[model samples]
Target: MTFTEQLRQENDDVFQKIFTHPFVDGIGRGDVPKDSIIHYVKADFEYLNAFMKIYALSMVKAKSRDDIRFFFDQIGFVLNDEVHPHHNFCDYVGVEYEALQSSSLPPTADHYIKHMMHHAQTGTIAEIYAALLPCPWTYLEIGQELLKTYKPTKSHPFYEWITFYADEEVERITLELRHRLDQEAQDVSQEQKQLIKEAFRKSCELEWKFWEMAYICETWPSEQEASRI
Candidate 1:
């Protein structure tokens, strides 16, 4: 099996947890509260900004023109293509996309972004890819899983979000990145490979936490609560 396949197999438990999470179930059922999704969209909008920065870091670290181009394409993908779902969410809930731009990253998103930034700043390209892989990869998996049981139509509140991630074009693009990571892994040392696995695992764990955060509308304590603590 390929490296991506191996990573997926090892992290299946976390993926299963994400698949069964209340946030995901709610999305599939079309009953997730607007407040929860709004919280998630605002946080994720900030997260996507950090994601682009990490890709920029990776582009700087890339050795070859092709590698640089890959990162460049991905940054463009996130900037141009990924935001449409957020727009859809905003439209459904009557939130302005511009407002999301100014929103703070919630705790879970902050942690996940920091995790990827750490690897992007200090790790090898393979490790950077490993760190970043789970975001899009798992979304693809979630979309696939949701499709198996839920048919999203125009009436579905999350139809755009569900279909955007589940699109054949998106699956194709995501798998291309997965295959690229596997190729990057082919020549890495065993120690580096372990680091890659650890990065991948942590990101997978964080992905699940992200869903939980949105489900509960997790946030930082208020100033008074923070001062007391």
Candidate 2:
């Protein structure tokens, strides 16, 4: 079997555990109230705009032609055209692309972007995959689970949004990245391989943190409201 397949098989239990975690359950429940989720989704879009900018910059800084091309293809074709269109994720999330072009973002978001860029610039291609792969992979996995469990109806505001990202394109991309990571893994030194694993773990943790931040933002009540609820 390919390294990608081997890793997937080996990590099946780990992935299953993550899928069943309470935090993911909370998101899948869609119990947070539509307005709150919308607000958080908007914030997430703003966050994504910042993310894309850094990704673009990293593309420019990429040492290899393949890396540069891959970054551009991901951003231009997948993110911009495929994912963003379903919800106008930027507009719905209240982030004008032009404004994102002009302004700064939260420190945490900036730090995440910087970390990914650093990996791209200084690390091996496998290291870069380790850093970049988790975001989509997590989304794809969660999306599939959610779809199986949570059938969307008209009552759900972002059902389309959820469905779009969870669909075939993202799945294909995730598999492609996994293949690339596995192929590149053989070429990396032992220390670098360890670093790649560390980076993947850190990236997954960061992803959890990102969702946690959204949940926190959504759950926070105003002082007056807090007293009532």
Candidate 3:
């Protein structure tokens, strides 16, 4: 089996759970609360900022002009097309884009961003590819699968959100990342493969928490009033 296929099989539990998660399912049924989506948009913008930095690092660590070009193409998509829908949705929902820009990440969002940054800053090109594959890959998969049943009509509350991930370009990027991961995995030791799998698993778990955080409208908790004497 291909490395991507193997990774999917190994993490099937999380993969399936992510697809069935209410935040995702609610989008399918057009039942997602506006507040939930708004909070999620705020947190996700921060996630994308970190994602852009990692893409820059990926370009620096890339193996060839082709790889470099590929990274640039994907980065452009993220900055331009991928984030465009957020602006429209934010406006329609009465959320200010500036507020999203200035908003702080909830703890779960911060944790995921730090994890990606660690791999981008310190990992080998192979390892970085492994670490980053799950985000776009899994999101693209979710979009495609969701659309199989529910058409993302223009009237759907989260239509912009749904359409962006399901776009052909996004799928292409996801496939490119998977191909990069599989190619790099070809020469790595089993230990390296284990490391990649662990990173991917942690990322999937973080992704789940991200949606959960928004569903519950998470924010940093207040400090305790005082310690008991």
Model 2 stretches with alpha carbons more than 4 Å out: 1-27, 33-39, 53-67, 82-108, 218-229
lDDT digits (tens) for residues 49-98 of candidate 1: 89999999998889899989888998899999998888877887798888
Candidate 1 off by > 4 Å: 222-229
Query: What TM-score, to 2 decimals, does candidate 3 have?
Result: 0.91
lDDT of candidate 2 over 1-229, digit per residue (tens): 8655655565565566657755556556654443334444545556565556645766655668886777777776544654453253344455554443433333444456667777867876677788887778888888788777887664554466567667898898788789878878888788877888777766676666655554454333354387797
lDDT of 3 by residue, 150-225 (tens): 9878887767777788888888877888898889999999998888888888888888888898888887765222
Q: Using lDDT, rank the candidates from best to worst.
A: 1, 3, 2
* Ten-residue region with minimum lDDT total, candidate 3: 220-229
Q: What TM-score number comes out for model 1?
A: 0.94
Backbone clashes under 3 angstroms, per model: 0, 1, 0
Candidate topping lDDT: 1
Candidate 2, residue 184: the lDDT equals 85
- Give the Å shift of residue 42 in candidate 2: 4.7
Put the candidates in TM-score order, highest first: 1, 3, 2
Q: lDDT values of the candidates?
A: 0.89, 0.64, 0.82
Q: Cα miss at 96, model 2 (Å)?
A: 9.4
